[model samples]
Target: MTPVPGDNPTPRPAADAPGAPAPGTAQPAAAGGPLRTGRPKPWHVLWLLLLLGWTVSAADRSVTGPVVTWMIDNGVGFMAHADHPHALGGLIGGLFFAGYMLTQFPGGYLGDRYGHRTMVVVSLLWAGLATILTGFLGGLIAFIVVRVATGLGEGAFYSNDRTLITDNTPPKDRSFGMGVCISGLAIGITIATIFTPNFIDFGRSVLSDIEAWRMAFWVLGAATLVVSLAVTWFFRTHLKAATVGKAALHLGAYAVVSLALIMAVYLIGDSTGLSDLWIAVLEVALAVGLVLFVLVRKGEEVGPVLKDRDLFIIYLCNIAILWNLWFFSFWSVSIVAGAAHSSFAASALTAGFNAGAGIIGFPAGGWLSDYGLRRGWGRKEMMLTFTGVQAVLTVAFAWYLSAADHPSLWVMGLLLFFASLFFNALQPVGHALTAELARPDLRGSAFGMQNLIGETGAVLAPAVGGALRDSTGGWTAAVWLDAGLVVVGFVLLAQVRGRRAVSPV
Candidate 1:
């Protein structure tokens, strides 16, 4: 096949080549001075800091599932009188992602127009405040409000964080840095799964049953606030601060619009007694309209990012991935416990194995992608291979859980670990491909568009899984559905023809 104009026709130099600097080796100064060595590069610090940000984000969200499950089990809080406990619990998660999804494109657009550094700090602060409020507010409506607010704040994080890593790291190390940075997600999940129930037990010592779970939110939120301060201080010199402009004001407008739409939907649902599923559909439909308005107004500048057919396929692909992700994230503990017939604590520990695998899987996938790059493999090849393998592993896991009367906890854990290894690894590869597909100036928009469409899966998976579980009277159907989505993602990703490499910005 003929190389496209401006495509890099040759493979990257082998590691032994002088042109290919080893990861962490200093490059010659842009001014052509001696190579600076021994000291850590700026991207290293950013990677560490951003990883912490992801850690906090993951922990905060991960706590919700276990907390809701506890509420249902003990007949306390919102789950006390819930007619459909599973669906209501899933709706809580779905609502958060509804707010989260609405902000994806706007947040990235703001980060692009203003500054990624500033947007990152802002996101952390907003999320922290909203999380703390959730603990303090303590009722059904207030709880929903705070979680949605938290989602709004965190929605900005992905696009900006992706930009920061890609902008700072060299081509060879780019995916690795993304992998390392996002590995915090695994760390945070492990923390939540392993420790959150313990935290609730601690809360039980001093607090009423109704209030005990609030302790988890208070602690996690406080940690997020502390991390925000550290990130602001550490990132001061590492990246440019956001430029203040009229464009920055739009961020607030986006937040207001999202909150209003969510509340409006909830109120309509309450008055008319609409189902949670219908409420979710209304929320997504309105959000889509908002997105279309934003894109049409900004079409001249963002047209390329919006129009790219390959990127659209990737966007659809991510829907399947995130559906698998949040299905597990929001419901994994319950799934594990039901399948294994274990205690809540044991199930959480077992589920942590799945989340924990990403710590290694992310970086390993990134390294392998880079290796494949040097060997002349396309990024599409690396991504699709991982996707297909993950689909198979997911199906195996689903079948094992459904078929076994009492599946071995260890076996279930191993299946989850390997399935997630491939699942998590493909993320950074996909992100790196996104960076390559758009120009530097438009990368934020490209990533924003990718996630904006992709996160619908996050929005739908929890509620749908829950509704299915309620209808089927077992987790078997939900688990199979999750497995099927992974297969769909594999097929969608295979249709992508993009093979653009990241050129020097």
Candidate 2:
């Protein structure tokens, strides 16, 4: 693939190369040399700003759990008086992931073909607008559809963000940069868990409980828009030049097709009263069809990305990671509240402990991976260790919940915090490994394809976990199932021989 002028991949430099500083610290100039000081480097600027982007994106998605929980408790909005309320709520999350899953590869392809910066900017704008729309739209169907649209827009972010960071940072610090940028994910989750309920309560003072959650969405959406403008301004000089006509012909067309596919599943299920399981299966079928279509149209280009067995393993392992991730992200508040018999505010705070772990876990894991490389270890080892540890913690948490009539809230918080530390750590380690495994030029598509396959787990986890919870009448079964899947992911990852050495620029 031909590189766009401003988005060409930067060659990775070897760690031992002179002038390379340790992962996070700045290098001092030679002894008696003048101090090197001025504006922050471009990579630093991108990393910091991208952290904000990830924060808002996370805040937008993480708000769902608190809002959904509020609805269920207050007997308001979509979950009010619904049979199998958890199932309905989970399905909403599942549908969002379905749209997110379908767009992964195509979004990455567009990022690679045009420019990562352009797609990154586009995604933020699209997500911000769609999120704001959700605040204004009423009813279940409207809410679901708008959330799906938001998912589609946000899907472009991961692949491009990873690619962009990898291109800008040296290989030594690449993982750390990616981790720091994504640390916002944990922060966003923390913010949502602790503050979203507050936002709703604040909204309640002026509006009905049914409509109060809209205020949370509106606040997050506006924050996202503000970040978009900041990014556009900061990246003005580096953005790829594209005509309005070209954008319409390419991105516009892609958006229309992707939305149509997602909506088709929603419409079919709605009209037929199909089970959530069947709806998810149908969405997976559509996703598979979309991939097959892409392969047929661009076989030669797509073939290289698909041919790696290890990459496929990594992709599959991510299914477990994401499954466990959204399972908690979508339901942790409810899980905590139900198990501990605590108030929504207290439960959210406890769950926030889990999400907050990521703030430390993400960067710590990345730094550890980088440190491991220097000591002859690899990203695979870091991922395997964290996955195994988290699996144990998950099972323990599940057991505690099942054994106690009212699980101790403090114990629950501690378990979640430790488990999530490992869980969140695995993310940056996995991304670093994926980048190491992929060719530089194809990194965008590779990351996209990774998420496209991994998100199958995301699509199924929420609805399936919810179904299990509803059927079993407790979160114990759902939590155990989550633990089992992560173990499966660990086994899959053990088969991967991730390359640790980088070719010097």
Please report how far candidate 1 places residue 258 from its true position, in Å.
Answer: 0.7
Candidate 2 to truth, TM: 0.91
lDDT string for model 1 (157-211, tens) is 8898987777656677788888998999889888888888988988889898678
Give TM-scores for every candidate, taking all chains together and pairing residue i with residue i.
0.91, 0.91
Worst 10-residue stretch by lDDT in candidate 2?
23-32
Separately for all candidates shown, the number of backbone clashes (residues 3 or more apart, or on different chains) is 0, 0
TM-score, model 1 to reference: 0.91
Tens-place lDDT per residue, model 2, 1-505, is: 2212222223222211223332222321211123247634445667888899899998887787788778888888878888888888888888888888877898788877766777788888888888889988878888988888888888888898988777666567778878899999899888988999889988889888679989999989999999988987766654545632353257657767877888888788868998776787788788888878888999998777787899989988988988988889889999999898899999999998899999999999888878787777877888899999999999899889888876898999999999999999889988988988887677889999999988888888888888888888888899988988988888888999887664322
| lDDT of each candidate versus the true structure | 0.80, 0.81
Model 1 / residue 337 / CA error / Å: 1.2
In Å, residue 469's CA in model 1 sits off its true spot by 1.2
Which regions of candidate 2 fall more than 4 Å away from where they truly are? 1-35, 240-249, 502-505
Q: For model 1, which pairs clash?
A: none
